[model samples]
Target: MTPRPRKQVLLRLDPAVYDALARWAGEELRSANAQIEFLLRRALGEAGRLPGAAGPLPRRGRPPKNPGGDTPADE
Candidate 1:
């Protein structure tokens, strides 16, 4: 199934929490936003709130399979 488009979200985290997230992101080689998404997915998965297999939320974007079976060079 195709994934849905992403919507912009604004979160107001405490200063300390934001700082810790930034640090964790650096350590994990991920952007702060990515880290936050990962954390949220993990939490949701643990709580069985994920849509399927109790897995992390799917990343928002098209899947790798090309509907027309075309390669990058075809375009």
Candidate 2:
């Protein structure tokens, strides 16, 4: 199935806040944008405001090279 298209938003933050968020994101190995989304999701879940249809966050890294479980020699 085709994935839904993501929405874009324009956000404004104080320089100090942005720097702190960037540092936290770097420590967690996520982009600042992803870190923001993660925090939002966590906040929603904690407040019982998350939607039932909300999907899990996207996978973080590259897909497996041999997804079909085929040996390289077989190819």
State which candidate has the highest TM-score: 2
Candidate 2 lDDT, tens digit per residue, 43-75? 999999999988889878787688667676566
Candidate 1, residues 8-66, lDDT tens digits: the string is 89999999999999999899877788889889888877998866744344544566676
Model 2 alpha-carbon drift over 4 Å, by segment: 66-74
Estimate the TM-score of every prediction: 0.65, 0.83
Q: Which stretches of candidate 1 lie over 4 Å from their true place?
A: 1-3, 53-75
**Model 2 RMSD, rounded to 1 decimal:** 2.2
**How badly does each model clash, as a count of residue pairs?**
0, 0
Let me know the TM-score candidate 1 reaches against the reference structure. 0.65
